[model samples]
Target: MAKTVNIEDAVSYFDTEVLHSGAWDEADDALRQKALNNAERILYRTYGKTYDIDDSSKWMPEEAVYEQALWMLRQDDAVQKTELGQVGVSVSGISVQMAGKPQYIAPEARRIIAEDGGSSPRSKWTVI
Candidate 1:
């Protein structure tokens, strides 16, 4: 999937501290683009293909959408870190405090998207 948000836009949406912490570094262009692509895919899958990334008026404001995109990007990063053994690693028999579960899209982001009038419609029904 093509990226819906660019790095500059994402940086604007995220905080300075966040960008500087290496959690979502602006210098990591490849990772940033990968995250944006992942985020776009998640949004497209969740909200359906009707979402027009080119049409700004069809969805939430740029900031809100980018915020969700950043969340998705961060989530992917966290998952990747976990998969690569970068997370929950400890040395010298010391315990390490781990971060929270990695989520594709946070509850707040969901609410924001939902409130923007996006819906996940079901085309098929199953009866038991």
Candidate 2:
């Protein structure tokens, strides 16, 4: 879990005050630690095979999906944009693959099968 402190009052980026927290620090470490401890405790709680979010038959309440989502969102890097540009994938000039002909024989019938050939008759048929 990410340790979220009151970074608003931070003096400097290299401030040791955040690392070696003191009593004068405005942020409440005890209250924050309590929540972290509770979260860790909740994660270790046992689960049953018959558990359901909607079912009212369980002993313990359903696990909070929103809390899990919040935890995942916080784990990702805050920086959406960066100075360096991303690289592109390397591929040879070009290559095309062909599909085999159909088994059934029909008069005046011709088909142009694409690389990603599909069996669905939606485009092949003109229904009235």
Candidate 3:
């Protein structure tokens, strides 16, 4: 079964739990829906497959999904960054170092995923 997180829940999460830019409130229904959809896809692709479906916490947390959705709305290039997952870049003698991994998952969300045992199998060699 595909798990879906409601946008209203995410909105409420931001409204009460997180300090945010209020972009979710400003966005139209379609755009908010798109952001939520993208957030879900990223979370599932990164962590869902490894979850034990029978576990009580099988579904991704609402707060995590909300964080990802807000991040997507705030950072337009989030999808590309998540895809790249690269650390640093240098162009024409200009070097730039990213603060952390490029995956679009928010830090708090990542922590939640880890705590919930939602991480995929991986070895040290894996960059993402």
Candidate 4:
């Protein structure tokens, strides 16, 4: 579930909205993983009728998936801005999310990675 956020305080602060501030995202990675695991289970059992058991947890809007991928890629220290400009970070040095399924990765990540300048690849999008 791309709805996973690292911050708990933020989770409470926001409208429980998919897109929220980063402050609530302070939870440890282990905790985050546990939450995501639970989310998948919940989704599979709760919304099985809406989405196949295999796909319920897997279902995500393209924009959210793209945002998630971008977040993961930026976590790597290698990503950088083009010519130290305001433009988004470059994917040339960034790495993909760890042990993540292909569904979680979005086409937009590659698009942002390939951009040359102007907009911020990382700052523009959100978890929502």
Maximum-lDDT candidate: 3
Q: Select the stronger candidate by lDDT from 2 and 3.
A: 3
- Using TM-score as the measure, what is the rank order of every candidate, best first? 3, 1, 4, 2
TM-score of candidate 4 versus the correct structure, residues matched by position: 0.29
- Measured with C-alpha atoms, the lDDT of residue 115 in candidate 1 is 73
For model 2, which pairs clash? Answer: none
Candidate 3 per-residue lDDT, tens place, 83-107, comes to: 5776566789997666655555777
lDDT of 4 by residue, 1-128 (tens): 33433334334433354363352265465654554454444433433343343454544323332334234433433233222333344478974433322232234433432342212223345586
Lowest lDDT block of 10, candidate 4: 112-121
Q: Number of clashing residue pairs in every model? A: 0, 0, 0, 8
In Å, residue 84's CA in model 3 sits off its true spot by: 8.4
Measure candidate 2: CA RMSD.
Answer: 22.7
Tens-digit lDDT track for model 2 on 16-127? 4235333224435554344333432332232223232234443222112212222322331221111122222234955433234322211111121111131222245668
Q: Each model's TM-score, in the order given?
A: 0.54, 0.19, 0.66, 0.29
The lDDT of model 4 is 0.38
Model 1 global lDDT (CA atoms, 0 to 1) = 0.59
Scored by CA lDDT, what does every candidate get? 0.59, 0.28, 0.70, 0.38
TM-score of 1: 0.54
| lDDT (tens digit, per residue) of candidate 1 on 65-118 | 455555655554447676555657567998565576555565665776767776
